[model samples]
Target: MTLASQHPMTMFGPDFPFAYDDWLSHPAGLGRLPEHRLGTPVAVVGGGVSGLVAAYELMRLGLRPVLYEAGELGGRMRSIAFADHPDSLAELGAMRFPPSASTLFHYIGLLGLATRPFPNPLSACTPSTVLDLGGVVHRVRTADELPTDYQAVADAWDKALQDRAELSSMEDAIRRRDVPAIKSIWNRLVTEMDDQSFYGFLAASSAFESFRTREIFGQVGFGTGGWDTDFPNSILEILRVIYTHADDDQVSIVGGARQVPAGLWTRTPGRLAHWPAGTSLSSLNSGRPRPSVTRLSRTGEAITVEDSSGARQDFAAAVFTPHVWTLLGRIDCAPELLSVPQWTAVERTHYMNSSKLFVLTDRPFWRDTDPRTGRDVMGMTLTDRSPRGVYLFDDGPDRPGVMCLSYSWNDDSSKMLTLDDGQRLAVVLRQLKAIYPDVDIASHVIGDPITVTWEREPHFMGAFRASLPGHYRYQRRLFTQFMQRGEPDARRGFFLCGDDVSWTAGFAEGAVTTALNAVWGVLDHLGGATAPENPGPGDRFDELAPVDLPF
Candidate 1:
C-alpha cells in the first residue's frame, strides 16, 4: 500500500489560473517596454495595496507612476496607533490574512514582514472561547465540547457543500492545481449556480431542512463569524472562499497589515530595471503620493488626470484601484472610458458594511485566573448580540494588551453605525458584562476606544464588494476588463485593478492578483511583451480565460 499527501492549496483559481507567483519569481522580469516608451507617465489612483503594487512594478519596467491618494496610504489596511501605547495597534481595517494568499505573501516575504497566527474563535492560537447566543453562555477550549446539536448543524453544512457544490472534488483539483479539472468542475458550477443565493443553496439541501439548523449555522459560521448577512450573496462567492481556503489557517502581520503597502512604497527593489539602483516609488513621487484625483478623462491619445492641487498630468496609461463608487460618485470620469456593460457592473456593485471597535488595556489582565472557576477571567467572546465578536491581544504580561471590543458586519454593523464612540464602547462593554458577569472589563480600560465604520468612510463607501444572486455576469465583465485587446486605441490605455475588479473580492490576494493583471495590461498597451519563458497573465489570457456565459 502507498499513500501520497495532497499538495498545498494556493489561490490558483478556477476563474483565472495563471501562476502569478511563478511569473513574479522567475529569473526573467515581468516584461520590458520599448526604449521610446521608457519613462512614460502612468496614473495610479489610490495608494492602497493594489495601487502600490501596480505602481511599483510599473516603475520597475522603466515607466513613471504618478500615484494619487485621497486618504492615507494602505487604504482599508488601516492600523490606528495611540500616543501612549506605541506597542498596541487598533486594526480598524484588515487584521487577519490567510496563508493561502501566495501572491500577497510574495510581497510580505519581499518586505521581510513577520506574521503570527491570529487568535480566531476556537482556533489553536486562542486560549479559550466563550460562545453566547440567546442570552446563554458556554465556555470551551474547542468545538468538540459543544452540544451534539451544534455538531449536527456543522455536519449539515459540510454535507451540503460536499453534495451540492462538489466541494471535495473541487478542492482536490485545486490542491493539484489541475487547470482542466479545476475549470471543468468550476465552469459547470458557475453556469448552474450563478443565480443561486447562499441561503437558497442551503434550503435546497436535504441535510439543512430545519430552519433552526440553518439559523445556527449562519450565526456561528465555519471559520470566521456570522454568515447571515452573506445569505443574500451569490453561492459562487461562498464557494470561492471555501474552495480556496480563504477562511482557514489565517495569520496577522506581526506589526500590522499596513506595513505591506508602506514597505512597497519605500523599498528599493534589488533587481532594478531601467531605473537607477537606489530609486523607489517614494523617491520617484518626491517622497509622497499626489493628492486626490478629482477628474479623469481622455485628451486625444493621452489619459488626463486632475488632482486636488489642480495640477494636471497626461499619462500614456492609467490604473484605477479604488472602490468603484469612488470613481462613479466622487471623481468625474468621461463616459467614453468604459463600455456600456462595464458601467452597469460598476453601478450594480453591492458592498458589505463592516464596523470594528478596539480599546487599549492597562495590561494582559484577562490572563488572570479566577480562584473559584480556575479559568482565565475573560476569553475571546462571540455572541449573537450587537458586538458579534470580541478578540483579545496579549503582547506580554509586563506590556499593555489590546482588545478588539467589537467586530460586526452588515445588519449587526448597522446597529452600531449611528452610535458615537462612547456609545459604541458602552454597547460592547455592556454585552461583555452579560457573558462575563464576574469580570469587569471597564476597570482595565486605559484609553478611549478607536472605531471605524467602512460605510461611513467618504472615499470607501463600503467595506468590500459582495456579488448578489445573478451577479456572476457582472463579476465576469469587471474582472475581464483589463483584457482590452479589441477596444479602441484611445480607450485601450485605461485599465482597472483592485479586489473589487477581481473574482475573489474582499481578500487582499484578489487585490494583488488583479494588480498583476493590470500591470500586464499596461505593459501590453505600451508595446511591451513578457519573456517567452515566464509569461504574464495576459500572455496566457487566451488559453486560460474565464468561461464566457450568455448575456
Candidate 2:
C-alpha cells in the first residue's frame, strides 16, 4: 500500500493522519525506556477502550498500568447477554464499526475476533428497509425504489457536500495519504466555517434550500438512520466523518463490541518489552482493575489518583481516558492539573445524548413472510415516529434472535431518559405497533427488554462528543494536548486520551488512536523513545498535527 496508488480510505486523516496502524505492526515495537523505569507504574484512569488500549500498550512497553474505573469495565461498549443465551444480547453503546477505523480493527485482529456485516438501511446485509414518514409506510429493497422525493434529497445532499464542503478533493487527498492537501483544504474550512452548524450549512446550500428537502433528508438519512438530532452539531464534525468514510460499510464484532476492551484486559501481547510470555493487563492488576477513581491531583512532580477504596497512589505519569466532562463532575480533579485553555476546552466539551431499546425474540420473526403481501413481516425500519430506527438481528433458525427496537439520539433520547426499562420498551412497542399493525410484536418477545439512555448513566454523563458550532478551537486544543510540550510543569505528565480527545469524536478509532498518542506521550515523559524505524504519532506531530484555528 504505497502512497502512489489510491487505496481504500481508512480513518487516516482529514485531521492528524499519523500511521498508528503501521507503528503497531512494526517489529521493533512502540518504544523503549531506561532500565530503571522498566517496571514503573502509570495510572490508567478509566476502563473504556481508550484506557484499556493505553494500559495494554503501556504494559507491552515494559511499564505497569494500574487500571481504575468508575463503572463497568467496557464503558460505552456495554454488552449484556440474555440469560442462558450469551449469543442473544444487546449492544447498549457502540454496536457497529467501519473498516475505516483501521487502528481499532488492528486491535480487533490482534485479539483474533471475527466480525460480520451490519444491517444498515438499504445496505447489502439488510433484507429490506421500511420508511414511515407522516403516517405513510414505504418499503424498499434499495433507495431507488422509494419515491422521487427520496432521490431528490439524496442528490441534493451529494450536491451540497461537493459544492459547499469540497467533498471530492478532501476525500481524494485522504485516500492518497496526502497530508498537505488534507490540511490545506480542511484548515481553510475550519477558519471559514468555525461558527457554522450542520443545519446552517445545509440551509445555505442551494440544493437544500427547500425546508421540505431538509426535513426529508434528516428523516430518511443515509447509512444507519435519521440524523435530525445532529443538526445542531458543528458542520466540521459531520464533514470529518464523511471525508474519512467513517460511516460506510460498517460491521459488528461477532460476540459483541465489549470483546474489544475485554480482550485487551486479558490477552497477553505477542511482543512485550519486559514482561514474561504469560503476562497481561489482567495479570498485572491481579485479574481485576482498581475501584472507581474518586479524585485526581498533582502531587509534586507526580500524578496522584485516589480510588473509591480510599487508596491514594502517585504515579510518575498518567493517562486520562474517561468522558472529558467527568473531570468536572464525577472526579475531583485538581485545577492545577490543566492549563487554562485546556480547562476551557474540557469545560466546553459537548457530548451527544443517545438511547437504545432492545429485546430478545423467541425467533427471527422479522424475517417471516406475510401470507397476503408476501413481504417479510417486518424489516429493518426507519420511521419519524417515536421508535425512530429499529434493527433486526438473526442468528440461525434454531437460535433465538435479538432486535434493537429503537435507537434514538439527542432530543429523541432525552424524552426517554426519564422512562424506566418497561416504559421505554412500551414506548417503542407503541410506535412499532403503529407501523406493523398486523403483526403482534409483543408475542414474539422472549426475555426482558434491555434499555439505556447514556445521558442518564452516572458514569457516562453523555453518549459521546459532538462539537457545537464555534467549538473548533476548543476541540483542536484538546486533540493537540497530548503533545504536552510548552505546558505548565504541573500538567506535563497527565495525558488525555479518548474519543473526545480525537478529531472524529464518536468513533472507537478515536479512542484507540488517541490512546496510542497518550502511550507515546507517557513513553517520552518517562524517558522512553520510539524506534527510529517506526515513529509514533507524537514523532509525526509537527508534520501531521491537526489544523489549529485562531480563537
Candidate 3:
C-alpha cells in the first residue's frame, strides 16, 4: 500500500506494512563511515525472526547493521527430522496457521516458500476427550455426552471460546490506543473467564460434578495443575500462556524458519557485517567512538568485545533482539529505563527451558484403509480424548501420506527430548500402537526421532515474550517509547518491537510488524533539522530516502 500505511509505528499486528521486496531495496545512505569500523550503526542481538526483521529493515533504510546470533539464527521457529527418515518434517514448536494468520500466509508467499494445508486433521475433529485433573481422567465431548455432574464443564469450555471471538472483534478500538474501554473489557472477560485457573474452572463447574463417578474419576483430565483438566484455562489464558501447549496456529516454516533470516541477510550489500567465526559479544573491541553518536560518555559509549583470538573493534549502536527474559538482569541498561518490575508470577518467574521433538512413521498411522473409495484419511483434532499434544495437518500432494507433529510445553518436553533417538521413536511408536492396537510398530518405523530444546542453550532462556498479569500496558509502552540524546525521547529512543509489542502477542507476524515501527523511528531520528514538510508517517520515509553510495 502507500507509505503512510507502511509506517511501522502505527501498525498493530505482525505483518510488515510494505511488500518484502520493497523493504529490502529501500535506499540507505553512504559516505559517513567512521575511521575504523567495528560494527554497523546498529547491532542486532539474537538472529531470530524479530532480530532478522529489524536488521533487514535498518539496511533498507540505508543504514549499515551488524547481526549477532549466539547459536543458530532461527531461534524457536525450527523444523526437526527423524534420523531414519531425515526427509520427514517433524515440527517442534508451532506447526500451522489459523485463518486469523492471513498476514503469515502473505509473507510466506512473498518468500516463495511452498505451503500446503497443515497435515494434522485431529485439530478439526471433535473427538471424545479426557481431562487429567491431578491424576483423575474425565471424558467429555458434547453437552449430551457429558458424564452426570460435569455438563457445565463442557458448557463453560465452549462458552469461553465464543467469548474470545467477541473479544477479538474489539481489536480496532484497542489498536486506536484507547486504554480505558479496552481495560474495562479486559477485566470483565478475565473475571468471567479466569475466576480460577482452567483446572479449578472445570472442577468447580456444576456439570462436572455429575461426572465424578468411581469409573469416571475427576471431571476434566487434560493438563497438570488444578486448571481445567482438559480444557486448560479459558481460551484467552491458554493463548496468553507462556508455555508451548498453545492453540494450533503457532507456526513452523517449510524448509525451516532459518531461511527467513538467511534470505534477508543475502539481500544486504557488504556494508552489513557479522561477528567473525568463534567470536562472542563479550570479546567485542573497544576502539574509536562513532563520530555520529553523541549521547554516551567514553565508557558508556563502547564496550570491549574480544574474539577467541586477541583481535577486537568498536561499534556505534547495539540493537538487541534476543529473548527479553535473558536480556533482563543480564544486560545493563540505564537504571531509569528499568521501570517495569521484573516479571515474578508463577508463570512470569523466569525458567530456562524449551524443547521440540519430531516423530515420523512410514504412513499415516491414523489413516483408515479403504482401497475402493479413497476418502480423506486423516482426522483433525477439533477437540479430543487422546494424548493432548499431537497435531496433524495435510502435507500436500508433493509429499505422500500425512505428516503429524506433536508439541509439548514448559518442562513437559524433558522426558521426550532426553530419550535417545531410538527411544524417542519407540515412545511415539508405542503411542501409535495405542491408537491402532493391531498394527506392528516395528514394521512401520521409518525414522528415528529428533528434538531441540532452547532451554538447553545458555544463550536463550525460552521462546518469545509472554504476558504476565499486568505486563500488557508496559509492553505497549515499550513499543511507543523512543531513544533520545540526553533523555529517553518522549517516544523512547530505545524502542521495543516484537510479538511482545504487537497485537498478536507472540508470533512471527508481531516481530515483522514491530520492525516496521523501528524503521520509522530511525527515520524520525535523522529526518532533518526541521520536520520534513511531508513527513506523514510511512510514505514520508520514502521522501527522506538516503543518498546512494557505491557498494
* Backbone collisions counted per model: 0, 0, 72
True lDDT of residue 216, candidate 3: 35
lDDT of 3 by residue, 334-451 (tens): 4343334322211243232445545455555545543543422233221122233444433434443333333444545555556665666566556544543454645644444556
Which candidate, 1 or 3, would have the higher TM-score against the true structure? 1
Q: Show model 1 residue runs off by greater than 4 Å.
A: 1-4
- What TM-score, computed on C-alpha atoms, does each candidate reach? 0.98, 0.98, 0.63
When summed lDDT is taken over every stretch of 10 residues in candidate 3, the lowest stretch is 288-297
lDDT of each: 0.90, 0.90, 0.42
Candidate 1: tens digits of C-alpha lDDT, residues 1-551: 11113477788897988889889999899998899998888999989999999999999899989989998999989987866877689888888899889999999999999999999888998888888888878877788977788789889989999999898888888777889999999999999999899999999999999999988888877687668879999999999999999999899998888999999999999887788899999999999999999999999989999998999989889999999888787999987888888999999999999999998889989899989989888888878988888999988899888999899998888998899999999988888888888888999998798999999999998899999999988888899899988798666788889998998889999999999999999999989999999999988888888888897
Please give the lDDT score for candidate 1.
0.90
User: After TM-score superposition, what is the CA distance of residue 121 in candidate 1 from its true location, in Å?
Assistant: 0.8
- On residues 1-551, what C-alpha lDDT tens digit does candidate 2 reach at each position? 45533587889877777878889888888989999999999999889999999999999999999999877789899999987788787999889999989989999998999999999999989999999999999989888897899999999999999998899888888888887888899888988888999999999999998999999999987877787999999998999889888999999999999999999999988788889999999999998999998999988999999999999999999999988898897899998888889999999999999899998888998888999989998999999987789999998777788999999888888889888989998888888888999999999898789888888888878899999999988888898888887778898999999998998888999999999999999998988898899998888898887776654
Candidate 2 — worst ten consecutive residues by lDDT sum? 1-10
Instruction: Please give the RMSD of candidate 2 to the true structure.
Output: 1.5
Q: Find the number of clashing residue pairs for candidate 2.
A: 0
